[model samples]
Target: MKSRSPLVNRITIVVCAVVLTSIVSMATTLAVSKSIEGNATAINLAGALRMGAFRLLAQAAGPGDNHNTAEPNISSFLDKYEASLFDRLITRAIPRTADHPLTNQYRAITSYWETTLRPGLENHPQGSPVSVEMHANTETYVDSVNQLVSMLERRTEARIGLLHLIQIISLAFSILIIVALFVDLRNRVLKPLRKLVSIAGAVGEQDFSQKANMTGSDELAQLGSAFDQMSSELALTYYELEERARSKTEELEKSHAALQLLHTASRNLFANHDLCSGAVPMLQELEELLGIGPIRLYLHDKEAAEPVEVVTTASTDRPFYCRDHHCNACLVSPEDYDELPIEDNDGRRLLLPIRTPGKLLGTLEVWYPAETGLSDTARRLLEILSDQLATAIFLERQITEEQQLTLAEERTVIARELHDSLAQSLSYLKMQVARLRRLNIEGDQKSAHESILEELSTGLNSAYRQLRELLATFRLKLDTPDLATAMRKTIEEFSTRLGKPVGLNYNLPPQALSPNEEIHTLQIIREGLANAVKHADATEVIVEILFESPQVKAKIRDNGKGLPVGEQPVNHYGLVIMQDRARTLGGQIVVKNRDSGGVEVILTFVPKSRHLIPTEAPST
Candidate 1:
């Protein structure tokens, strides 16, 4: 295995390069500056030496008679010049060689001072002629020293130019190094980091297809590898979770479909009051839901002592026979047949017992292919269907019985009404005819004969009126479900039959009366209207039905001659019947003459059954 340099090392290298370059640049600058400073010192020393030599020469060349006075000044100038020259040579560290131009000049000047000028100046007195030679030599030495100073100045200028060049080069190199570092950082660190950021953002959005294709022996590469692993694991986990959710959803859908099928079948079975009308559709629904067809339903006819096939899906010529034991098997122990389907030649049959709480109504037989047996779910659904069918059948039978009982009760009422009104009236007429025949044979008084005839006529008229009232009561029909509409019809019938205006002010709440209450109320109103038309001979009649909580009131008023001023007609059969109806409704009826000069019949009742009270008023 091979190891590469880490990011830190690479960065360190770049920093070190910058620092090293800076150090080198500074060193070069210091070297150049020191060299220029040394050259400046040399130039200054040389100039001083030249100035001292000129002074010595000038003093030496003074008037010959003043040579004694100028001697000390010339000696002082020589000493100063020697000191400046020695200082320049020592400071410059230049050898006395002729290899370099400035060095050779300096060495020549030093040799001239040491070997000739110094020897002459020291050997000859200041006032002697030898001093003249000394002045000339000093002037030449000053000129040479000036020439050396010029050369040193030129050298210092060249060194300054070299320093400027080095500084410029160093600056350019530093800039290039910085640019390289920036480019390297962008390529190696910033770009890859940006890619990682983008990848992370993609991962957050649940898109895992993209990968960090970063390549290096760096930490970012290792991080990318870890990220890829995490993404792969997360994707795999998500796939597994999705598959589980899909499977669970499928299971839930299946359960819901079964429940819906059962619910629909139950609704269809109970929706129809007559089970025979709904049984075919229910069987078809069951066949569809169970994925099997050819269903037959057999209901036991206890009166006929046989099983009747009420509904069947299959068209077969062969009749289905129910044996004694088969009916008993369903009725006695339903659980025995719940485990498995019964095998048959055409297919398998599942015999489910249709039973109510205590009675076995019938058996439901479902036929399926032999290869496909009944599933537990199918069996369970079949049991539920059978239960619903049993319930529907039970309700149907109960409703049929109730209808028959209501018809019987109505017949008994009609018989009683005939016996009470028509039978008694006819018996009276027969007796009157017998008496009239006897009186005619005996040849009685004319007044007595007229009275008998008049009585007969009145009796005949009253009997005819009672008969008409009975016919009207029997003819009354409810065209709509609303009690208000029924009341209006009753009022209209009376108005039309009596040839009198009948007005109905109906303000009762809908559904406030049960079927029994409605019937009794209608009859009572009919009786009241009949009395108004027959006895009152009213010109106008008004019927009012008012509803209050827990009680209903009906009022009938006629604008006719008030009741006779005598005992009430308590024994009148019509009035007695009206009172009976009111008693049956747990209420009472009152008949009185209005104070304003008419007859008024009022009936008030608290409904017998609270459960039968309707929530809203009947629609007219």
Candidate 2:
């Protein structure tokens, strides 16, 4: 890295170089002027004096008449001689200074002019004829004048040579300065700027790896460093973005896979109500999906409080167990459930909670024997799977309870029908038989016999009607999937049956229901809805069902005439049936006229599982 000048300094150097060159040239001109200052003027004056001397000599030789008319003559030799001697040019040429070489000669000439030459010229030079003495004096004066002119001419020629030499040196200096400035401009400014431009072009082409060679103290050098830094940072950012994008793509793939698993899991869970039958296979898939070691699920079926179940994907022996083997304490104890992820056995295992909003259904314990704990994507998938498993367990329990409830409801219907129809008919027939037994061969025998026949006919018809109704009730199976879907179907059915629209508001979480709560709820809602449609003559009917954690509430409202005044709802078979269903659910039903021109049927029940759904800690 060679040293370099700053831009300001470099510019200053070039300016100074040019300025110095100009000063040198100006100084050279001044030196030349000083060297030959008066030489040229003095030479001209000397030459004029010499020519006057020759002209005076010529005039003395006789241009007095005819020849003098052709050439000009020095008619007054003294006047001409004095004027040339006293002229500024002649004075300047001959010096009287002590250091001057011409001082004596100049003084001698002054003496000659004042004393000898002036006297001689004044006496005879006024149109005088030529003489030997005059001629000799003129020639001597002319010889002196020639000597002075020759010396002046010689000194002026020397000065001219000096001027030429000075000019040559100044020109060389100026050329050298300009060439130096040009080289400096190229090195300091142009080359570095080109480097920066090249780096910029590389970066514009998305080649972030290019860097400028930074090696000076100049502005261009600093700019090159800046370009290098910019490229470096861009390269880093580009790689970072690539890494992030790669990780994001991998995460998306994991999410897609997790979604596929959840979809299939939900489908299978819904298709089969027996939980453990699918649980083992699902746990196996989950273990493989996560690439973790074997996994186990601990379930607490609140219904069968005595026994806890642990389902495992791998058939390996259980490494650990609780002290209470029969009760399976580890599966049920609150301490065994971990809501937050925890690493065990040197961070190779995790225990996650299987929970819904209403209850803590189970615990999922997983391990990775060959590696550390699961990655974030794996953990998120596991959490989602835990939720699915919780719901699956809930659905399994609800299905079981629903099946039992349906059987029990059928039995209760049978008992109620038998009590309402067959028992009464049999009782009436027994009464008729007793009357027959008690009667003797009396006058009213025909009347007694006709009465007995009528009783028998009446009892048989009653039995037949009850049988038809019981058959109708038992012959149909529920067509819809879940309770909400069933309720929606029921409402739609009533809407069509009543020839108008029926509004339904149903909100129920998929959860386990009490012994007969599901069937009872559905039956009670149906009964209330039917009454609102057929009996109330409703123009609008709204059926609303909401299930809180432990309680189910339903309402059937109609914007129409309510029950007839002073009518007792207890007497109606539909109302009686609703009441019976509500009672079976451990709930109460109410039928009343609304102040707003309608009748509202309300039912509220705390289904048995409502007790099982852990109360929200008085906080939730």
Candidate 3:
């Protein structure tokens, strides 16, 4: 499915709002119906209690009793005891009609009780002789009331069922509408918007020739119109901006060119493969640029080692030397060397510290022969250039450190592989050779003995070749197709040691891997397969290699009991070693379980370094 555009997203939000409103409105209706049902149930329960009370009274009385009452006594008695009696009756039989369905039937029963039974109960006292007729008369009314209550319950259930059906239908319809809307918006709008966006992006890259032909006058059309207009205006403004920009750009370019020269000159000062050869040329350039009569560079040291005087020039006009006390400031803090009368004869001198990251690398001092002095820009620029030199020095140190790390990791891997596979095999061969030698020494010249000796010789040669090849694994100075071959042989040895069969399945074309990517791929594959064989308990493993331009993929799969959820293999040293190695190669690892069984581990490495490849070439 295509992603929704901003306009489609807005439409979706609006539709969602309408759907939510409908849902809330339905909820309100259901809530109101429930409230009304509660009230009706309460009324029904109250009526049931009143009617039940009257029926009980009538049952206690005999037939032929006068159950009717006169107006005054009934009215007065009702006013006093009707409410209290009703409460007592309900509190005993049915306290509330809430959640009960026979509400209407109970209401009718209560109405009949108020008009007929309550009046009689008020007018006649207990133990009245007129009770028999009252009992007979109310018996028929009781049967009718029971039937009515049953009907009311059935009707209540039906109504509730209907409401539930409406709710389900409402939800189903709303969901269907949303799904259809999304499909329509995706195909009709989102896909087209994406095409327009791509064209717009190209236009932004200053390809003003690119245009979007919006066929219809929809919102998308307006967007295309706005985009086209922007491109046209951008083209017109490009020339004006370019002219003004060129002036400023020229200034910027000039500044950049000057900075480049400064960087190059400063780099030459310390960029010695050997410091001894580069030092003199640095001082010569400095003297020529600054017009100083005499210059000297002193390297700062925390411990006393005779400071190497890198460069020195004799003053033609006057001799200037660092007084004994001035050397103290230069040694401890070159930044505070301003206290010294470092000025030249005409009051123009310059002192700069080549410092990086706290420690001082060195200091440069120039003695002017005339009144002219270095400007502020020149001073600031000199300090900046000094910093660049210091950084370069630091970088050179790091390159050495990194090379050592790479060599060390390579050595470790080679040593471990040899120790685990080739060494053990060689030891077995030695044991066989020793046994054959003992047999020959004993003078057992039987046919079997001769055959064994010949076999041992062949085995020794094979072991020799294998050991030499195993040692060659460490000699990988650059990533190549040969590295892949070495890695495959290593995996075979690993599988043999583990008593499992492993196969290498690849379709990598020739010259498909970069030097760095090739090394990273070898390492990741080595580690991944080793992990799977050791931990996954698989019988057979298949390794797949696919090379697509700009990306190369390697995957290892085994048909073993899959890894447990959230489980990772234990790495005693640290699991991060593999992860870090991958990151260094600008790659990542993904491990997952196949649906059938076992584990799958994949690694992808891409070159992100500009220094490693030609800039104009597309990624391979």
Q: What is the TM-score of each candidate against the true structure?
A: 0.40, 0.49, 0.26
Instruction: For residues 91-154, write the lDDT of model 3, one tens digit per residue.
Output: 3333156545454445555677687766666555544565665665466456645555455455
The numbered model that scores best in lDDT is 1
Off by over 4 Å in 3: 1-27, 30-34, 37-51, 62-111, 119-136, 147-166, 197-218, 225-620
Ranking by lDDT: 1, 2, 3
Q: In candidate 1, how many Å is residue 371 off?
A: 60
**Among all windows of ten consecutive residues in candidate 2, which has the lowest summed lDDT?**
316-325
Clashes of each: 6, 0, 10
State model 1's lDDT: 0.70
Tell how far residue 340 is off in model 3, in angstroms.
89
| Candidate 2 residue-wise lDDT, 1-620, digit = tens | 96555888877877887788678777877876775677778777777776776565565555345455665444455476678777876676665586565555556666766776656655655455767876677677767767777767766676677777777877787787788877877887787778788888998888987777778877888888888998999889988999889977876786777678777877887786545445556666655565664577776543333223446555322212111123221132234323212344343667788888878877888776434456788888888888888888777666765776677678668767776777677667757666765666557577777676666655555554434444433332443223655666677788998999899876543333533465567777776776676568788999877654446678989988887888664324567667877787788999888999889999987655324222221110
Candidate 1, 1-620: lDDT as tens digits? 86655777788888898899899999999988876766766777778777776665555555445446644555666687677778854456453455988788878888988998776665555544545567678778778878888888788888889999999988988998899999988987898788788878988998887777767877777777777787888788888899878865764565567678768767767776534445655566656656675677788653334555656654422122211111221122335323223353446777888888788888888877677666666777677778878888788666654653574468567856887878677778867776775664345577787776777766666665666566556545543323666787787778897897698877654334556677788989999988888789788899988764446889999988989998765335688778999999999999999998789999999765332232234322
Candidate order, TM-score descending? 2, 1, 3
Measure candidate 2: CA RMSD.
16.8
Q: Flag the better candidate by TM-score, 1 or 3.
A: 1
lDDT score, candidate 3, position 73: 34
